[model samples]
Target: MSTDVEINLLDNRWDASVASGMSESELLLYRSNVLGSDKRVTNYGGGNTSAKVLEIDPLTGEATEVLWVKGSGGDIGSIKMDGFATLYMDKLQALKSLYRGVEFEDEMVGYLPHCTFKLNPRAASIDTPLHAYVPRKHVDHVHADAIIAIAASKNSKDLTQEIFGDKIGWLPWKKPGYELGLWLDKFCRENPDADGVVLESHGLFTWADDAKACYDMTINVINQATEWLAQKSEGVAVFGGAKHESLDVDARRAVAASLMPAIRGFVGGNQHMVGHFNDSDAVLEFVNSQNMEPLAALGTSCPDHFLRTKIRPLVVDFDPAKGNLDEVMEGLPAQIATYRDDYAAYYERCKHDNSPALRDPNAVVYLVPGVGMITFAKDKATARIGGEFYVNAINVMRGASAVSEYVGLPEQEAFDIEYWLLEEAKLQRMPKPKSLAGRVALVTGGAGGIGTATAIKYLSEGACVMLVDINADGLATTVEALAAQFGGDVVRSVEMNVTDEGAVAAAMAETSVEFGGLDILVSNAGIASSAPVEETSLALWSKNLDILSTGYFLVSREAFKLMRVQDMGGAIVFVASKNGLAASPNASAYCTAKASEIHLARCLALEGAEGGIRVNVVNPDAVLRGSKIWEGEWLDQRAGTYGTDKEGLEEMYRQRSMLKRSVLPEDIAEAAFFLASDLSAKSTGNIINVDAGNKEAFTR
Candidate 1:
C-alpha cells in the first residue's frame, strides 16, 4: 500500500535573504497565506501567524512602536492586515513574567501603556512571545496532520527516528505559549542544524529566509509523513462497518445538536462534527471496550485546533444488535454534561495570571455510531472548517497508532486560547455576501426581441426583473406573454434613454440597491444607425455614439466598479449586434463604436476576474422588436432610403443570417445567465453568440 516513492525534506537552514526588510507582521502574514495552501501542515485553523514591527507608518502619525500578531480568532488562509493585533512590547514582556495572581483582566488590558487596542484597531495575538522567542526573523507553525498522526502513535516517536534518521526533531506536545517557547528555544539552541521539528500530538513548524522556502519545507515534511502512514496503516479499518438499524442521520444530528452547547461554549462559532458511531458490532464493541474510556481518552490532536474542533469526539455507543433512539438520546445529555464539567475544570487549572472565565465553546463535532458526522456553524463556512479539522485529525490518529490512544493538550490550555478575547474580536469586521435573494432586477429593453426575451429568461430563473423599453406600450403588452408564468415580482417596466448618464446610473443604482446589489447587469442599450457614408453628418454621428456605443460603456463601467468592491463578484452582459462584429455601410461611427464597446468588455473581463467578476458579450443578428434600432421612425426611413418597403427591409435583415428567424432577447439572457452562475467558474474571458451561426466560429 505504500507509495512508490517518497520525497525527503531538503530545507532546514535559515537564510538571511529571506528576512528582507519586511515587517514581522507582513512576513508572518505572508507565510500564513502561503502555508495555508499546503494540505498537511494545516487544515482550517490549524496554524497561526506573527511578526514584530520595526517601524510605523509615519503619515498616519500613529505610535511608531508596536508588534502585531495574528488575532485570537481567524483562519490562517485569508488573514488580513486588521487580522493582526497591535500591542506595546513593554506591556507584553511584563505579562510574560507575571506569576500567580487574582487574574487582573484590567492589568492585562492596561499593561500595554504604549499600545491601545481600540485606538489602534488591531490588537495583538496572545501568543506574542512564542514568536518573540524565536531568534529567527520569521516563524511558521502548523498542526502538521501527518507529523501529528505519526507523533501521536506509540510507535511514531521511534518511527520518526527510524524514517528520517537525523533531520527530524520531536517535542512532546507541550501547552503552547511561553512554556512551549522556552522548550523550543532550548532545543533550537541545542540542534542549530536540525531541518524540521514535529510536536508530538500537535503539528509541525518550518521557517526559512523566504516564503517559498518555508512552504517547500512544509510540503516535504508532509510527503514523508504521508508515505510513512501509508506503510503503517496499510489496511486499517474504517468507520461504518455495522449499521445502527434504528438510528437515522437526522436522529443523530438532533441528539448532537442538543448536546452541542457544552462543546460550543469553549469555542465561539463553527464547530467540527463527526458521527463515528455505528450500528456496527465494532463501534458497540469499542464503546464497551474494557480499555476504551471514550470520555477520558477522546482528546483532540492539538490544542490550537480547539476553536474549530473541541477537545473530543462524541463517541456514541448505540448497539447495532439492540437499543432504541430514545435510549441513545437519553444518555447523550449526561455525556454533554461531562464535557461541560471537564471544560470548566480545565479553565480552573490552566488559566494563567489574569484571563476572564471562558465563554461557551463555539463548535464541537460528534461521533455517533451509524449516523454520519454533522457540523454546526454560525454560518456554513465555519461549520465546515471545524468539521474538516476533526475528520482529518481522526484519520491521522487512526494511522498513527496500531491502536491509537487519544492524548490531546490539556483542556485548560485549549480553553485559554479558544476563549481568548483578543481572538474573537478580530473575526467581527468583514463584509458578508449579498447575492440578492428574493429581489427583482429591472432591465429596460426586456422583450422587443433580444432584450425583452433576455429579461423573460432572467424571470424564468429566480430574479424579479422589471423589463423596460422606449415603447412602454409594447413592454406592457409583452407582460401578457410572460404573465401568469411567475409571481409579479419577476418582471416590470420603465421608459428611459440610455444617453442620460445621470438618470441611468441613478435608476440602475436605485433599483438594484433598493432590491439589493444588482446580481445580473446586461447593458444591451443601443440604436442601429445607417446612412450613405458620404451623406453622414456630425449630428447623425453624434446621436448614434451617444445612444449606442457611449451609453453601453457608461452603464457597463458603473456595473464593473459596483461588482468589484461589492465584496462578492457578479456577472455582466453586453448585447452587441452582429454589425458590431463585421461592418455595415453608411454606418461608420456606429460600427467603430460597437467595435470599441466589445473592447471595453474585454478589458473589464481581465480586471474583474481577480474579484471573481465576469464580463461577457453577446452578439445577435438583426431583431425587429423593442430596440429603437428596429423600431418605427428610423427603420422606415432606412427602408425608404434602401428603396424597399418595411416588410422587404425586415426580410433583408433576417435572410442575411443562417437562422432566418430574428434572434430574441430571451435567447441572449439565457447565455448571459449561464456565465453568471456557478456553471462558469472557469468560463471567463469569452464572448458568447446567441446568433444563428452567422459568423464563422473564431475563438478569442
Candidate 2:
C-alpha cells in the first residue's frame, strides 16, 4: 500500500470560492492536479496525504496555524474541508528531536482533541509523523505501480541505486504502521535532506515545500523509473506475428483515441496512461499472447496497481467481432486456462523434487489474437501499469527464444519475491539502491581475505550476499563481522568446498532463498598450486580443476538459473589470478585453473548477453590480505627460486605495475565495486586491472 497519487487526483477537488479574505490563487484548487495525484499512487487504504491549512491555535490565540493532512478514507480527488488534518508546526518539529523512529499513529491522532481538532478536516494521514518528518508543507506517500513494480523486481535494488543514488533511502518492506514509522524516524535522522523515500516491496514518498514540487517529484520518480524499467526490460523484435507496424502520426493518435473509450468506459471517466507500454516488441508480443490473463500478471508489479485497474486486469483475448465486450465476455475462461498452464509449466521447470507448487500466478492479464489485450485490476492506474508490465514479460520471453534455453523464476523463488517478509523488511533497513536491492549475490572463498571484502561491499550496496569458504572458523569470522554491520539477513556465511556439485547446489539454493534470487555473483574462491610441470602429478592436476575450474562451473550454473528466471540482468565476475593472463613457472595447476576461469568468463559473457547477464573477470596480481605476499614462506619460496632477498622479490612484483605500489585487498574491493555499480553500467565481458601494470611485462 502506498499514499502517492497519479496526475488526476484533482479532478473532483472541492471548490473554495465561497471563503472570504483568502486569495483564490493560493488556495489548494490551484494545485488540484497534485492533490489528486497523491491519492492515485497507492492501493485501497494504502497511503496517506496531507496539505497545510491555515487555522487559529485556540490555546495560543494566534492569527495563523499549521498543516491539515488528509484523514483516513479521504480520496484526494474528492476530499472536503473537514478531511484535512491540523498539526501544530512547532509541536511537529519538536518530535523530530527525539532521534528515534517510533511511530505515534495513535499518539498523534489522540492529540487532535487539543487544537481545533473538531474544526480540523479529516483524520490525519496515517503517516503524519512521516509527513511532518519532511520539512515540507505538502507530503504524499503512495505505492506507485511503476516504482513498486521496479521495487518488486530482483534488479530493482540495483537499478534504483543507479537511478537515485544516495538521494533516497530504501526501506525494505515492513508492515506500514508503528514499526515502519520507527524505521522512517531513524532514516530521516540519518538523511535529513532526502526529497523522498523508496519503500522496498511497497511504494514511494515524495514531499515538497509546495504542492507542485511534491506533485512533480512524484511524476519525475515514476517517469524515471519507467524509462529505467524500459531499458532494463528484456526487449526484442516482434516474432510469429505482424511484422510491419508503421502507423504514422494520425494512426497513432487514432489508436490511443480508440482504446481510450473502451478502457475509460469499463473503469470510469478520467482514465489516462500514467505510463504507457509503447515499445513495439512489448505491444506486439502482448497483443499476441495465447492467453492474456497469464500475460497480465506481468502488467502491474506493485501497489500503484490499484490506482491503475484495482488489483489485476481481466483479459479479452478472443475475437471481439461483436465489439470488444463480446470477446471479453467469452475469453475469461480460456484466459484463466492459459494463465494456469503457464504457471504450471514454470512450476514444473523450477520445482525441486520436494515442494508442492501453488496454483495461482502472482497476478494475471490476457486476450485472444487480433483483439487488443486488456490489463485487469481493481483500479484504472494499476491496469495501466499492468499494460506495460505484461509487455515487458513478453519481450523477455521472446528474446529468450534465441537462447532456446531460457527459464523463468523457480516456484519458490517467485513466491519469495512476491511475498517474502524478510525482503520487505530489507526495504525498511537498507537504502534501496534500485541497482542491487533484493538481489542474491555470492562471493566465492568469501572466508579468504579478498572474498570477504567483496562480500562486504555488495552487502553495503543493499544486496543479499552469501559469503562462501572452506574454513569454518574463517567463514564464522567473516559472517560475524558482516552481520554486525549489514545484519544477519543481508549477509550469510557458508563453509563448503566448492568442488562438490551437490554441496555447491545445496549451498546455492539455501543462499538463494535467504536473499530471494541470484543477481551478482563473484567467483573468487580458489586454491593455489606452484608445482613445476614435471613435478605436477595427475592427481594434482585433477584436484586443481576440481576445486577451481569445476567449482566455478557449479556455482555458475545455479546462479545462471536464478538470474534467468527473474528476468532481471545479472553480473558474474571470476577472480582469476594474473597468472592466467601472463605466465608463471612451477605453477602448472594454479595457472591452468586460472586460465580456465578467464575463458569461462569470456564464453559465458557471450552466451548470457542475450539474457542481460553480464560476465567479467578480475585479474589480481599478488594482492596481500595478511597473506605471505609481504613476508612469509610463499614469498620466501619465490625469492629462493629467483635467488633474491625478500625485498628483491617484492620489488619484482611491484616493477610489473605502473604505480609500483603493492596491490592491497582493499584495492581489489574498490575495483569489484565499480564493475558492480552504475559507474560501468554498459560494460560486460571485459577484464579489469587490479594489478599495478603486470600486462606490460608479461603478455600471455
Candidate 3:
C-alpha cells in the first residue's frame, strides 16, 4: 500500500464574509446547501442538519429556544429558509417524559406535532431528536460516502479509532428513533471532548456550538477519512479486480437496449416502470468486478441507500467476454423470477406480525456483468436516483472492502427499516399517480407544433416522452423546454428521419434504452403537397408518400417490434389529415398520402388486436395555426386551390365547416391523447376528426 495516492478533499465552503451578518438559522441553511451540493457529502434528500436558535414566540410573546432542522422528504441541496421544521426546545425535551422505551419509541413520532412552534406545516424528520438532543447550537448529520465506508466496515469501531482517535466516538447500530436520540445525548455527555460520532451502518454526526465550526468539522472529518482511505487502499485491487472487461461503448449500449425492454416487461406487471441506464466509470468498475455479486448480495448499509436501491441488486447473467447477450436475454425471465422469489423469501423470513405486506418484488437495481447498471422504477427520476444510490454503495464497497470487510446492515435490521410503519405511512401519503404515470411514449415529428403539443399533453399526465425529429435544432429546443418543465429525466430527444429504415430501427432501440419500453406511438411525421393531377411531378408524389405513408409504416414497424418484445399492449395513434377522406380539387398527393395513413391504421388495428396493440387515427382539417406543413408553399398552394389568400384560407375552411370553427394543433393534440391513453382502450381501428366539423371527412 505504498503507491502514491491523491485525495480530493471536500472544500470548506464557508466564507467569513458570507457568514458575517446572517442569523444563526440562516447560517444553518447556508451550511446544509453547501454540504449537500456534493454527492460525496450526502446523497440527494439524505441526511439532516439543524441549529437551535432563539426566536420570539408568536403565541407566548417571549424569546424561546426553537429547534430548526431539515424537514422530512426535503433535499438540503436546494432547501430554502421555509424548508426547516421549527419546534420548541422545551416541548421536544418534554417528550422524553412521554417516551415508553425503545419498543414504543415509534409512538414518539405521534407527539412531534404537539411540539411544533408557530404551527409550522413542514413536518419534522425522524432524525429531529438526533439533532435536538445534541446539546449544540448547530448540528449536521450527513451520509458522506467516505465516512459511511468506514462506518459500514466490519471493524468500524476500530477503524474509527485508527482514523480520528478519540476525536470521534462510535455508536453501534441503532435504527433512528427516540432511543437513538437519547443514546446520542448520553454519548455526547460522557465524551465531552469528542467533536462527532460515527453511527455504525448509518452516517456521521458532527456538532459545534457555532454553525461555521460545525460545518468545518463535518468536512474536515470526511476529508480525513478520504485521505486515510486513499493511503490504505492504494495499489489494492478494486472490488477484487475486474472479473470481466467492459464492453465497448456502443456494445454496452446495445446490450442495454436489448435487455431493458425484456426486463421491463417482467417487472412492469404491477405497474409500468420507466428505466434508466448508467454506464459511468464507477458503475462499470463494480459491475465488471469479481466481488460485485457478493458485495451486492450483502445489500447497502446506509438507510438512504437501501431505502431507494432496495436490499440488493439483481445480477444479470451476462458474459461480456463472450458477448453472450442472446443467451442472457433468453435467461432473463428465469433470473427475474428467481429475484422475485428470493425477495419473497427474504420477506417471509424477516416479517414481524405488524410488518407492512411485501412490496413490489421486482429488483430496483440490475447489475450487468460488464455492460453497466440498469434501474427501473415507477418513473424516470426515481429510477435514475436509484442508480445513483447504488453508485454510492459501490463507492462504499470500494473503500471498505479494500481496507477491511464491507458489511451491509443485518438482514433483520434491513427488513425492519424497509417495512418500518413510519416509512409506510409516508408512502401512503403520496399523491395518486396521473393518468399516464409510468407509461413511455415516442412522438415522430416531435419538434413540430402538433408533436410538441401532444408531448406536453402526455407529459402533463406523467408520461415519459422521447421526441424524434429530423430537425436537430428543433429537437434540442423542444427537449430543453420540456425538460425544464417536466424534469430532464423524463424528456429525451433523438434526431431521426422516420423514412430512413435504419434510423427508425435505431430510434426504437434508443427509446427502449431511454425509458424501458414504448407504450405509445404518435405517428405525426408527414408532408403536404398541393398540385393538380397533370401538374403533380412524380418526385412530388413520391416525396409526399415517402414522408407520410412510408414514414408512418417505418415508424410503426419499429414500434411493433418493441411493443411485441415488451409483450405489453401498446397504443399507436396516427395523426393523419381530413383530406384523407375528403377529396379536394388539387391536393391529390397530400390527400392520397393522408388516405394511405388512415388505411394503414385500419390495417394495423386488425393486425394488432390479438396482441392488444391498439391502432387509431386522428384526422385534422385546415389546421393552419402552428402547423409546420402549412408554413411555406403548401399554405399558398392551399389558399390558391380554395380561391383565397393565405390569411383567408383558415376563415374559408372555418366557414365551410359544419360547426364553423378553426382548427389548431392543440385540438389535434387532444384527439391524439385520447386515442393513445387508456381512455380509448376499447376503441381501435377508428378515426377521430378534429376538424371542428367536416361532414365530408366524417367516418361512415
> Considering every candidate listed, which one attains the maximal lDDT?
3
Rate residue 653 of model 2 by lDDT. Answer: 69
- Candidate 3 accuracy as lDDT: 0.92
User: What TM-score does candidate 1 get on C-alpha atoms?
Assistant: 0.46
Report the lDDT tens digits of candidate 1 across residue range 1-700: 1222233333333334764776556666666766665555577755675555555545565655455566655667778777877665545555656623334332343444345444566544445556545545455677766677776676556777877766768887665555566566677778777666777767776655445565566667777777776665555443212233335544544444333322332232222111111223323323333333343255665665566666665555555356445576567557666766766776677776656656553225555444445444443344555666765666565455433444556665566666655554544445542323332345656546666666666666555565655566776778766776754434555566677776665555444322333446777767766777787888888887786677777777666654543335667777776666777666787777777777888888898888777777777665565455667676876687667888897677677567776665556667766766557768766777766667653243
Q: What would the TM-score be for candidate 3 when compared with the true structure?
A: 0.99
> Which residue pairs collide, candidate 3?
none
Per-candidate local distance difference test? 0.58, 0.58, 0.92
Ranking by lDDT: 3, 1, 2
| Predicted candidate 3 versus true structure: per-residue lDDT over 427-501, tens digit per residue | 999999999999999999998999999999999999999999999998899899999998888899899998899
Ranking by TM-score: 3, 1, 2
Poorest stretch of ten by lDDT in candidate 1: 269-278
Instruction: Please say which candidate is ahead in TM-score: 1 or 2.
Output: 1
Model with the higher lDDT, candidate 1 or 3: 3
Best TM-score among the predictions, by candidate number: 3
Error of model 3, residue 524, in angstroms = 0.5
lDDT (Cα, 0-100) at 655 in candidate 3:
97
Residue-level error in angstroms, candidate 2, position 491:
1.0
Candidate 1 lDDT: 0.58
